[model samples]
Each structure stands twice: as C-alpha cells, then as structure tokens.
Target chain A: MGFELETADHPERLRRVAIDPLSRVEGHGKVSILLDDDDRVRQVRLHIVEFRGFEKFIQGRPYWEVPVMVQRLCGICPVSHHLAASKAMDVIVGAGQLTETAEKLRRLMHYGQILQSHALHFFHLASPDLLFGFDSELSRRNIVGIAAAHPETAKRGILLRKFGQEVICATAGKRVHGTGSVPGGVNKSLTAAECDFLLADSARMIDWSLAAVQLIKQLHRQNPALYDNFANFRANSMSLVAHDGSLDLYHGQLRVRDADGKLLFDRVDYQAYGQLIAEGVKPWSYMKFPYLVGLGEERGWYRVGPLARVQNCDRIGTPLAEAERQEFLAYAGENGRSGPLHATLAYHWARMIEMLFAAETIAALLADPALQGDQLTTSGQRVAEGVGVIEAPRGTLIHHYRVDDDDLVSVANLIVSTTHNNQAMNSAVREVAKTYLDGRRLTEGLLNHIEVAIRAFDPCLSCATHALGQMPLEVLLYDAGGAIVGRLCRASGGGLSS
Target chain B: MSDVFLLDGEQVPFTVGQTVMAAARAAGRYIPHLCWHPEFQPHGSCRLCTVKADGHFAAACTLAARPGMTVDNRTAELDDQRRTLLQMLFVEGNHFCPSCEKSGACKLQATAYELKMMTPHFDHFFPDRAVDASHPDLLLDFNRCILCELCVRASRDADGKNVFAITGRGIKSHLIVNSPSGRLADTAMSLADRAASVCPVGVILAKGRGFVIPIGERRYDRQQIGAAEEQ
Candidate 1:
C-alpha cells in the first residue's frame, strides 16, 4: 500500500501520526502515536473507541442466558466465551463436578472451536503477511493473493477450518453461537454419525496442523534476527494448567510466571482470582488493563495468548504437540526448558502446536464410549457467586458472577483474553513504531510493522470492547500542543491513505 | 349451537358464542394470535389472526363463526397483512431470538417462521422497556412483549388475582403489573398460578429455569408451527 501525503488537516505543523482501523485484525481499533516538535515519538495507545457494556447490561437477567448471550462478544472465538460462561453457571447450579459424558462433549466442542479459530487466524488473516513480506504491495499481500500463489496451502487452511466447524455443529448443534453446553452439561453428545464424520478427518487434520507448524518454523529460520528481535521484550506470562501440570485449555488452576521463568503463583484457585488479579482502566480506551493485584498495574502488566501459554505451561497434553513443544523450547540450540521464549513472532508456531493438540484431543474424545452414556448432568448444593476460567485461544479468560436470592444476576465481571493482553499489545506496537520510524511520517513499512506486531496476539477488539465496529490500521501524530499534525490510515479493505 | 363454516375451503364446525379462532382450534386448525389463550376469555388485542370472513376483514379471534359463511384464513393477501402486523410487533420491541431463553418455544418466533417473515421490513422503534425480575419465582421481560394480554387474561380470569393489566394506546401501549409497587413480587402471583406460564412469547417466565428444556427438544424445535397441532 502507498499513500500520498497531504497537510490538508494541519498544514506544515506535523504533530500526530495515527493508524486508524488497524487492518487484518479482528475488530476496529487504531494506534495513536503522539510526536513532538522534534518529530520524536512520545506516546502510543491502542484504543477500543467503541463501548460495549455486556458486563453492566448482563445483570438483572436469568443466569442460563449467559452462556449464549456472551457469544455476541466475538464471532471468531465465541465458543470460548460460551464454555467459560457455561462453566461459571455450572458452579451457580452447584454442579461442581460434571458427568464424564458431559465433560467429554464440552471438551470436544471446545477443541473444535479453537481448531477452527486458530486455522482462520493463521491462514485467512495472518498468512498473507508471512507469505508475502510485511512491506509487500497491498494488492498482492492478502489471503486471495496467497491463494493465487500457494493454492494447496490455502485449501488446507479452508479444509481445516471446515473440519473444525463440522465438529462444532455435531457437538453444539450449529457452528456460530451454538447452544450445545448448558449449565450442568451439554444439550447432547456426539452421535455415531457425528463420531464417524469427525474420525474420518482426524488424522488428516493432525497432519495439516503439523505442516502449519513446520511452515512457520521455516519462515522463522529464514530471518531469525528479525523474527526474534522485532518488537521482542521480556514479559511475564499466565495461563491455566492441569492438576498434573500439563497444558490444559478447557479447565484448570491459574498460574503466573515471570520473565525469567520464576513461578510467582501456582495452583491459585480461579474462584480466588479476584484476590490475585485487579483490573485498571484509562480514559482513552474502553478496554481495561488487568494485572496481578500483588504487582500493581504498571509492573503487573504481562503477556497472554499462545506465546504466554506455551512459555507458562510445563508441557502439551497431546504426544505430537508435546514433541513440537520440546523442539520449540530448544529453538536455535537455546534450552528453554526452564525459561520463557520472548519472541512475539513465535506466537504462530505456538498456535499451530495448540491446533495439533486440539485435533488429537478430538480423536481421543470421539473413541470414548461416554459419548453414548445416559448420565448427562449433575447437581449439588447451590452457590450464590461463581467464577469460571478457561485458556481461550488467545489466553486466560475469566468470567465471574453473583446472583441474587431471586436468581437474577446481580454482578458480572468479565476479564476477556484480549483485555488481559492490552498492555502487551500497546507495548508491542510502540516497539515496532520506534524501530521503523524513518523520519517525519510513517511509511508503508512502518504501518505493516505495527500490523504484524498486533496481529500475532490475534487481538479481537470487538471482544475487547464488547461492541461492534470495523477494523483496519490508522496512525495519528499529534504535537505537544494537542493539535494533530500528520495522519496515515489503512482501511479494512486494504486501502491506504494519508 | 352447532354451526359449520367454510374456512380456507375446509368445513369448520363451531358452537354458540365461539369465535372463528375457537371454532378453528376446536376443529384442529391453528389461527395465529398474540392475545388469545385457550383457558381465558378472548381479548382480541393483537390482530395477528386477521382474516377475510365472508369477504370482510375481521379478526378471527373475535369474529363469531356463522353457518354457510366463508372465511379465508391463510390466503396470500391476508398473510401479507398478518406479516406486516408481526413485523410491527418485532421492530417496535426488542425481540432478540438467539439469546432469549424462550427462543425455541416462543409462539411469536414460531408464527413469524410459519408466515415466512424474512425481515422486519421497517425501521426499528426499539422502545425502551425495563425488566422486572423483582419476584423470586418469576421474571417479566417486557422487551419481548407483543401486548398479547395472555398473561393479563390468565391472571384476571383463571387465577382470579388480577395481577396484570395493559395500559396506554397505539405505540405507547404497554403491560403493567397490578400491584402498589408495580412489581410482580408485590402481587399475588406465584409459581403455581396459571398466569405464570400463559405467555405466548417470552414475557412472563419462571426464575432459575431458563433454557431448562434444550432447544432440540423444545415444543417447536423439531417441526414447523403449522405442522404441529398448536404452538
């Protein structure tokens, strides 16, 4: 993409550079880079200008509506929100332990959901950036362009996503916004036909997922210096881990580790998450910043998602993915067995590994005779307040709720995955901005750099804001006097303007 | 008392004082209505049952059946008008189907599907309506109310509690609780009351039981409303 510069809005007094509607990302958001008279970058902020009040408005409603209601947050990863909310309601209904069949069905739905979402993000959205250089021509750098150049790769991505959707349909009923999982258990389990349908493609999907990881690793090897150093920094990490300390995406205790791989907290009950984490808000952005309460806001801000989860967890649950995780930890002959990988670009590799795990998990769940069991739900003593935490494809997603005696939800607190990574994304964008600043204004290369940095986390602004809007890249530069000096915008349709 | 009328070419038998809606239902026919319930007196509020009775536009829920009379129930022209009525009901109020607990079993949603209503075809009024969840055993979501008076009629007639009523006119029309505090908790309504489950839509529902019946197993889930004996 190229832009023709014009001082139309602010004459020769260049003050601000903004990338409005950041492109190839999930939702509408922009980057504002405040500059000084010396043309030096001052402050950079990623803002969720749209306000979505799902937290406030969710109150005074019946508790069962939650699992389906919250899916309105994001189309990409709705199953995560659905499962997280359902888990919270399970606690509300006093079903602390679910029947084996119910748990298996829910797990199957989740794996299908994460598999499809990761495939869509890696292939449909982020692949163009990797296949073509970040600074490649706008017209020639997109999914369509990639399809023209590498048809087999593009087809694999589509088929992989399709297989995931089919699994969701079998378990949840329909793909997007399905009502499969209820408070105590899922509505239904995988039928014989459904099991057959999924099993037919399980081996193929695992193969494709392996290929994707290999592809990203090869891409990283081509330019390790840029891949490793670009927008890289040391940061703390967090995710959910199984009781045995294996990678658990569906359910587990909360764990947090620092940059040097020091365990700050392990096996913290998610119900006590309120004591461990506190949320911070700024006036500019609607999205909130969440940090470990012990560390406070500024120092506690850490990274989450694929990168964070891989570094935080001890091992992957599935054998194939576990092997890849080991290889990834030893990248470039560096022993990461006892450390965290700080490269943001490694998120792609981590995501593909997770996808492989999901595929393998799907195969295991289908073979279980529990899919045909009659024990579908369970109940115990009820609780007024409940909290649910799951490792969403992005990272730790927390949903807490309190119900009145009447059973209407009185309080709701949702720390979405993207909200947890808010500070990390802002810092990543800032690092890219500083490195790619050529002179007075942002070039196409700088804009692409910012996009590539943000896209790795796969941030969903709609989910972050809990509102709806467009997504593309735009940067605004404002002088110290607060007047906007220069601006660059990339529309969602890949049109660049200045 | 026994009378026969031709409804959309089928012979429908009726008794004295029976409305077209009653006669049709008694004879295994479904006449769509928002305000009429089987166990209550007809209020004829929502005119979703608009029909051509002997070549005159009439509400089937209120129109008395007469022998040797012809009534057109599901004609294209009448359905067009009925669709417009349903559309107005939809856009005027918040009828979010996917998230509503009453989604799979709601008659308003089922009838809309029966009529093949593709879209609302008008700008949404989006009238502000507040939820009344004050009652421990009940939740009143007025946002989905079509002003059908099924709850109103059941409360006043069957339950003899007079716990509900409708006020205002035209677009300002709304459902109100017949209590000093204007909340269901203050009324005599209980989980056992017939008024509690009379809502043809999602307006009056019991607390803590949302989505208890999974979607696929709900009343209208497996078959179209028309194919079923009743909504």
Candidate 2:
C-alpha cells in the first residue's frame, strides 16, 4: 500500500510509506509513515479504513432490537455490546434499576466475556509476540508456535478460554451471539447444573489465571526497558469504578484520571456521558477521537482498556487481583505520587490481573442464591432516549439511542472501547516510529516494533474501524531522495516477508 | 409404499412426489436448507439445499425424490456452492448477526454454520433498508430480509390475509405489505398470525417479545436447527 506524502519542509519532494493490512489484529487497518526531504520522520498515522455505518443504518430500527443488533458490531466482544445496549434499553423501558436476579446474571455473563476475551488476547494473540520475540521468524510468533513450544501453557490458555466460553453459553444461551440480556432484565436464569459445571473448574481456572499473571510479570522483569520505553507515553485514563472506587467492569459510575493520577471526575452518571465526553474527528481515519469534555481536544484525549482500567480504579474488589494490583502500582510509584502507570507494555499485566478478578467474581456470583431467582425482567412505559455504558474487555463502551414515538431508533451513537484508545494508539505509533525509524534502514523486524506497540493495546479494529474486509499489514520506507527505498508486507498469517 | 434411495451411502426412504429435502428430513438426515420450512410449501428460493443427484445439480427442496437416486448431499463441491450462496445472502442484506434478534435461531445463520462459511468472501453491499414499526405490537426490520418468501406464503395460505407479498425481481426484489396504506399498521397482521412467526430471519418480530427466550435456552442454542429432527 502506498500514499502520496507532502512534507512541510519539502513540499516539492514526495515520500510515502504504508502498512497496507495490519495483521494479528481484528478487522482491517494500516499504518502510514511520511518522511521529509532530510530523511526525518514527518508524520505517522494509523488509518482504520473500514467504514461501519452502524449508527446511520440502525436509526429506524426499534430501540428494543438495539441490544441484539449492536452486539453484531464485533464478534470478539459481542457480549460487551449486548450488555451495554441492554442497559440503555433498561433506561428506555423506564427500569433504571433491574431486578436483583437480572443484574447479577448480566454481571456474571459480562465477567465471563471479559475472562474469555482477555484469555484469548493474552494467550492466543499477545503471548506469541512476547514469548517468541518480535524479531523472531513470523511463523514462530503466533498461537500455534506457543502451542508447540509451551504445550502445557498453551493447554491452559485453551482451557481457560473454553471455561470462559462455557460460562458465557451457560448464562447467555450461546457462546458468540447469545440473547440472554434484554431491556429491563435478562430472559433466562442460571440453572443449577450450569452453575455446578462452572464451579467444578473454578479453582483450576483461578490457579491457571494466577500463573498467567506471574508469567507476564516475569517477562516484564526480564526486559524492563523494552517493556517500559516501547511506545510509552502518559495520557488521561478512563474506566468504570464502583462508588467506593473499587474496580467494577459491569456496572459503575464513570471516572477519568489525568496522567498525573489526579481525578478529573468521579462517579459521574453514565447517562450524562454526553456532557462528560465529546468526540473529535480526523480526516485520516473512520474512527473518532473521544476526549474528556472539559479538557478540549488537545488534552482531552484519553486511553482506555486494561491499562487504563487498572490505573483509574482504586482497587479491584477481589482479593487475588487486589494483591496483584498493589504490586503492579509499585511500578508507577506509591500512593499515586508518580502518576498513573504509562508503560504501554504493562497493558498485558493489567489484562492478566483482570482475568484473575473475573474468575474470582464468577465464583462469588455462582455462590449467590440471587443468581438462580426467577425474576428475570421488569416492564414499564418506554422512554424516548437512553444511554448504556460498560467496561468491555478492551475498555469503556457506550451505546446511546433516541427512539421516536413509534419506538423506532431515531438517533444512534456508539463510542466503542477501541475508539477511546484511537488517539493514544496514534501517539504510541508516532513515538515508536520516531525512535526506531529516523535514519535506520526499514526492516521487517523494525516494522514489527511498530506492530508490537499497537498490539499492546489489543485494539479490535473490527469494532473500531468497522470495515467488512481483511487488511494485511504493509510497511514502506522512503529515503532522502523521496524514493521508495524498501518495503515489507505481512502475509495473511502475519509472516513478514519483504 | 415408501421408496428406498441411497443418500450418501445411507439407505433412505421417500414417499412418492416428496422432494429430496422432505425425504432427507424423513430419514433424519439434514441437508442444509433455508426458505424450505417443513410446514410451508417448498419455495426453493434460497437454493441452499442444492445437492448432486445422479450427477446433476438440483435444488433438494423442489426436486422430486425417485427410487435409487443416489443423491450426494455432503460433498465438497455442493458445500462450496451452499457456502457461496450463504455469503451472497449475507452481503445482499445487512445480516449483522450480533444485532439480529433471530440470530441464534435464524435459518440462514444456521445454514452458514453447517457449511463452515468463514468470511462473507465478497464485498458487503451494505444496503440501506427500512424498519417498519408502525404496528404497535409488531416490528419489521426489512434490512435482514433474505427474500425467503416464507412470510409471503404463510400470510397468503395460513393467515389468509395476504398481508405480505414479494415485489420486483433479482437484486431489487423485496418484501412488501398488501395494505392500502403501504404500512404494517394498516394491515390485519397480529402477533398471533402465522405470518408473524414464519419469517426465518429477523424480518417480522413481536415488538415487546424481543429477547423473551434467554440466549442459551433458545431453540437453536440448545440444538442445531435439524438436530431434533435428526433424533
């Protein structure tokens, strides 16, 4: 892939570099780098080419169909969309608070989603790069290679993912596109057998989850500089936190923390998200840049997902994860002195801790008798507008809908988790490209360093970019003469062949 | 008397005048199908059930079964065609599974799973369609319509109201209402009508009844579409 580059200093000279289709990530996207006549990096942008006009097309559909419809946005995080939309519907239907049974069941399903999604991201997607090294042979830097090299670890990963999927199926109805959550409440309750089946392996899942956390910690210990300095930059962080400031992925108020760990806002009503957040548009990408409302575009942009979640929250409710959180914060400094953790690579560590918390949360929910209650839904007069927000495995996900008197959706807006990280991802790519690619010859391994930076966020381009196509990664190099000096393309399976 | 035929090396029985799809269903074999509901007259519009019978391609839902036909239903060549058909149907309409209320139970989605169709394999048409919610008790999302014509037949024959019909042809073809007002609100359609439930996709849905069955316990979630019939 190629694009015409016009630099400020050298308007006459043109240089272009492109990564056509970024691999090992969900959906289609590419990275473009522009160099000036002096051979200095001029600009770096991650372009999301897929245009999913879900907002425009979903306008006329009934608000009740939203929860099910929006989940189709991403296969990887359908449950997040499902729950977020359902919550919005709950507001539309005038049931601001769900029945105890419905709330607990939805929370259980969400945790299962987070658990499975994190397991997949860590074991299947991220581990290959971390374990095999970014510069390793492309063939050896994937889930299959992990399976071959570390059989037991791979097995645990698969089983962990299976357990999470089983939990989702047990609660929601099906693994992928479950229909369990609805407006005002859930449609089904957990059967005793389903609960028992999950509990049977809960202990083992927890053990394996802890081990996974330890593994990431060890990886970080081995290469502190690489993990810390690679695309590391400070920015605002956002997540949902319980009233007590405990981590609450499923239900909580919105909280935003500046890079210095200062709380900009806390316990803000999610329905009031419009007042707290505003989106900035860029000509280059389909994804919108969302920033905190009061901060304006320049400083308002924030990071979400695992790292942001762990940094923004005070403590995780579960004991094991809370312990891990304490240890993780040591890297950022004690008592919030050094500000929120900005080490981009530490996202993997934060993800593992969340996995542990999900397992523990699942166990606690299973033991609650409320999970089996028969009250599945509440009914009331429908309202005209509603907003739903939740912490997807990636980060804070928002769904807002306005229905007409006919109950058809008249206006729809969604800010997915990856969109929240769009600005941060671009900043990270710029940093990595500037540090590694200024005068050095572009190589496959060097290009991979950029991909590695993007991978740390575990950005789901499908949800973020919304293209209904495949995009393979390509990297182009330009010399001072404004000519294509070198090129690298990623095959479908992520092998970097020049 | 039932006539015996060899289907994929299994001895299967078919009644005279019954189509291959019906015969296969009778023998507890599932040839992937959409728009060929058992209760309705065979439409054969979806063409998903095309199987090789005696070295020729024919729609299983319409082709009459004969004794010793030696039909090959599960061959790679036929599956590939079915996969292609499913992909085309996916791109033709906005069949976003995650947002579809009928997703788990939708016949088109189930057929795609049976055929192992991975990607849409073609550019998405991303067609713009309308959602008719004028009817207080019913919601019709035309975006997901696969043009199966099951609703057309069910409305005409079973409900006897002629509330629905197909208009246009080829890519321009779409489901239309029969009322003078050109809206579902003016039609005699009700939640109790057979046409309301006949849609295999998310075209016709009871407005307030969405997500009535929790995801895991839904019809297809418990078992594959034809799994119960297989048993």
Candidate 3:
C-alpha cells in the first residue's frame, strides 16, 4: 500500500482530510490522512492522481524526436528532462558516445539549470520568509516583498538566473525548451565569445552567492524555532551520477546509503534500474512509492535530494562545498548523517554547496580550452533499452526507454525524485502533526513549518504528477471520548481536491 | 531529372516524394524558416525561401525534387525573389526594423539583408495599435508583427493550445490572442511557454531580455539565420 499508518489517539478512528490543488512547488498533488479514534494518526495516503500517459504518448514517436517531445514534461526543468531523455536515446541508439568536449558542454548547460533552478527556489519561493518576516502577512510575503526588502539580493538573483538563461539561450538558441541537445551530442557549440561571457557571468555570481550564503546562515541562526525538528526523522539517502561518490550531479554511477551512513549500493549498473528498484502503485494516487530491492513496503522507504547527495558523497570536489559539508558535519549534533539539518536551514546550505560546485565545474570546463573544438554529433545504430538518471534540483530523475529497430521509442518509464521522497514526506507530515499539532489550536507558524518542511525537498509536482490536476493538504481531528474534538484546519499550501 | 546535392555535403539517396528543404535537413543541413516548422502544416505565404531548382526558380519548402536533379540554392534570380518578398513583408506589416527588438535576430531581417534589400520596394504601413503588456511574462507589440502565422501554428500544432489567430484581412489583417479581451494576461498563458517563444517577429517578446543582449550580440546577428532556406 502507498499509504502509511500512523497510530493516533484511541481505537479504530479514521478520518479523511484531502489536500487538493497544491501550489508554490509546481503542478498538483493530494494527500489523504485517516486519523485513529484517539485523534492520533492512522493511514496517510499521498496520491499523485493525475497521470500523464507520456510513456504511452511516446510509444510510437521516433527516437530522435523524444527529446523535443519530453520537453513538455515541465517548463521549469525542461533541461533536465531534455538531457535525461537525450542520453537515454544516446544509449539506445548505441550512440553511447559523447566527446569529452561535448560532455563538458553538457555540464555547462546542466549548470545553467542548477543555477536558475536554485535561484528560483531560494529567491522566488523560499526567500519570502527571510527577506520579509515569516509572519509578515501572507498578502505581502511574495517576490514583490523580496524586491522591496532586499532589493539588491532579488535583483542579483534575477540577474544570476538570467545569466544562466543566457548560457542556455546561447547554446540551445532558446532559454526554455531548446533544440540543441540531441541523441549523440549537442546540435550547436559555443563560440569563444559566448564561453567567455558565461565564465565571467558565473564568476561574478559565485562571489554574490557566497555572501548570500552568509546572510542566509545568519537568518537560520536567528530563527532556530522555525526550523526546529525539521530533520528529526532520518531516512536512507540515494543519489545518481556521482563518480567515486563525490558530489557528482551529471554523469557517473549511482550510490545508495543507509541512514547509518553504510553504503548499500555503490556504482550500481544503471541499465538494470527496474531490477534494482521496484515501484509499488496504489489506487489512491498516481505516485508509485519506490522501494529498495527486497526491502518490502515501509522497510525500503528512502529519501533523495540535496541532503541525500551531500550525505552519500564522500567529498565534493569544489572547495567551498567541501568546507560547508565539513562545517555541517562538525555541527551536525553527533548524528553526522546530514539528517539533523533542518528543512529551512537546508535551503541555504544545499543551495550554497550546489552553487559552489556549479561555479567550480563551469570554470574548470571553460579553462579546458579544448572545449572550443569540434561540435560534431557522432552517431551509431542500436536497438536496445537504455536508462539515464541524473539529479534534477528536486532529486534523482530517471528516464528509461525501449526503442525499436526503426529508432522509434516503443516504451517509456520515468521515476521522478518527488516519487522517491513521497513516503518520507508522509512520515515527516505525521511527525510534524505529532510534534506541532497536539490537537489543540492550529497556529499559522505550525502550518508554515509543515509547508516549509515539505518544500525543503523542493518537490516539483509537475515531475511527480505528470498530468494536470490539483493537490491540497487538509487536517482533521477527533477527541478520545469518540466525540468530534475540532474541525481540522487546512494546511497552508495549495493542493488538488480529489 | 538531375541529382541535387545537399549543403551539408551529404549525399541523401534522392527521394522523389520530398521537397529540397526536407532532403537538405535529412542530410543534416538545417534550413531555417518562418513559414515552415516540422510539426505544422507548410504555408509558403512567406516566400523567403525562393531557390534555383534545376536551373529554375522554386520555393524549397513546397517544391519537391526529382531524380538526377541539380538544384542551386544560391543563385541570382532566387535572391531577387527573396529580396522582393522580404521588402514586401517589411512594407506589408508595420516593420519598424530600427525600433524593432527582432531587428537583428528576425528571420525577416536576415533574409532581407541576405538578398541585399537595402530599400523598401513598397510603401511602409505604419499602423498604430495598442501594445498589450498585460501578459505576465510576455509582451505583445502589434506594431511590429509580420503576420508570419508561426505563432498560430505553434499554438495549435506544437502545444495543442491555440491562443493566437490572425484577424482582419489583407493590409488590415493583424494577429490577435484568442480572447476578445485582447490582453494576454487574462487569457490562458504562462511564462516560458512554447506559444510565447513562437513569434517570429518582435510582435511577442519575452519580458526580461528586451534590451539586455542588444542588437549586435543577438543569436542570429553573426550567422545567416535563414540563409540556407533562402539559398
């Protein structure tokens, strides 16, 4: 079952509260909770009701056409979907070939996504609380507030995001759903002028990002209560494309580790993803709760994202990210699993770490000089199944496809990051209720904490739900004497009422 | 019938059913276009791609090649047609090329220059229309539209969302968003969407980068953006 049972108050007590029309993240999702008789907690079902038949949609589409087609997945993370889908085709077409320069170029494009996405997450979504007070009236707390409160930060974040956009705009000819990346390699290569511009822009952003990190860190320290119990529950972590388990975001092997920091799977064969990971589907939602091999049900539940990647990687190559990781570990309250890090705090730390790595990687690539060479798209013929997995800002995004002899995609499957973390979020929500909600009064701060904790994973519901719908979060309560205790106040975020 | 060689220098075993443009792209030669998108039905309303096919003038987008066909995409006669078409489009719509954001990167501008269209052959239609800045992340400047119908095709074909359509007729014809509200803000639109990116001219512009990159540093400023098709 996709639902998790939480022991609430008394005897067989179950009440359904559905969160419909989920907002702030992307797309839609709904969560239904069944409360026990004592108003404690019963079963929590996270339903991804809307299903996009993309797998069926792409069945007859030519392999070469998959990239442009899959770009429809999400406007925000189109690059990730584009790259992942293209790489999957590359493997299927036996075009398992990308020049070293092409790989670096791909990384350069990927870095654009990293910068833009993290900026959007930090500035557009989460920064409202920091720039403006958390309780600064819902009507006033928005991107407009950030612009008014810390005008320079908002302006710089926007500029940085545009710089990243320009990098994509330069190479792919458009910032959004670009037609540059193809099966074997990139369609267009960057000129010296473009590369120079990208390098210079990224370098400046790195300076701004470091200072911003400090500002965020200070804010985190001031509001310890806001982030309390954020990391109380620790789950197994997983990340893909990290070579030698060192903060690799784009291309390499995958690593899965237990909560105790023990390596469960290292550099596992990506082609056999179906065998290694199994998705359990429930009638309640479209989101398939994925589990580790043979872990069965709740036993195999795991989490993946920035925190997971940082924890699983032995070291991040970049100096700043490495230092931050060290600092986080040192002050991690003895758990040392990157687990105790609060959701609100994780925003700045993970963002800085990612920013540091993004800058270092792009700079290294630009300095390589050979990246200015041939943009030839080497091709090959192949008829095999291929799987490409990369960490989008959300978490591990996997694209698996089977192609026919005619080079048309016959079958497709995608295991988005949000899906992987769905179960973990359910557990977190339960814990949040138990800790904050005490069945008494619903404070806006508690509601904000619940929403912030969920947003910490930076869930991209468009990637999760795939189809169009809404996701809403509702809360209900009952007294121990089998009497209605209180009307469940709704959680402060958007959700689709299903 | 003579064999036509592709610009990419690939010898695509001549197909009798397809146009020269198809053959060229199939051979890895990309021919840029305004009226020709792969997913949309072809409309040769924009005669920007006139080419010499087997010693005769032909539009590559609509003209299918034959066996043993020797077509010259770069020729004097075809270049003249391209210039005339571009100049006509310039004068046909309110193409304030100087004030236009699409000046450098515009396919209309690129083709006009490629054909050495130094002067407008016809009188320019300086039509006055209201600018719709209502859309959240996109801008609509009706004064700069070329009426290429790319936006229409993009909305209907690519995204399955037909948010744009051409209204009026002849010189009076202009592109309009789906709703009579005439404001993209009220209509169904999103930032970073395919419809927003489809406009060929400065009629629709992404809000953020209006004057940032400037005219010279624009993407198509360096290369002959629509040259291959013109050739």
Report the C-alpha displacement of residue A453, candidate 1, in angstroms.
0.2
True contacts kept of 2: 0.88
lDDT at B157, model 1:
82
Cα deviation of A404, candidate 1, in Å: 1.0
Q: What DockQ number belongs to candidate 1?
A: 0.55
Q: Flag the better candidate by TM-score, 1 or 2.
A: 1
Model 2 alpha-carbon drift over 4 Å, by segment: A1-14, A36-39, A137-139, A334-337, A464-473, A480-482, A489-498, B1-130, B141-179, B187-203, B215-231
Query: Which scores greater on TM-score, model 1 or model 3?
Result: 1
Estimate, for each residue in B54-157, the C-alpha lDDT of model 3 and write its tens digit: 56766777877676666666556666766777777777666755334455677677766766789997887666666676665677777667777888887787
Candidate 3 wrong stretches, greater than 4 Å: A1-16, A33-43, A130-136, A223-228, A333-348, A443-445, A464-498, B1-231
What tens digits encode model 2's per-residue C-alpha lDDT throughout B60-148? 99999999888999889888988999999999998877666686788788878877889999999988777788999888888889888
Q: How do these models rank on TM-score, best leading?
A: 1, 2, 3
Which ten contiguous residues of candidate 1 chain A have the minimum total lDDT? A1-10
Q: Between the candidate structures 1 and 3, which one is better when assessed by lDDT?
A: 1
Candidate 2 docking: what grade? medium
TM value for model 3: 0.66
lDDT of 1 at A6: 11
The residue-by-residue lDDT of candidate 3 on A384-429, one tens digit each, is 6889888887788899998755444678998888889888776676
| Candidate 2, A128-228: lDDT as tens digits | 88999987877677778898999998999999989999888977778987788989999889878878888999989999999999999999889987887
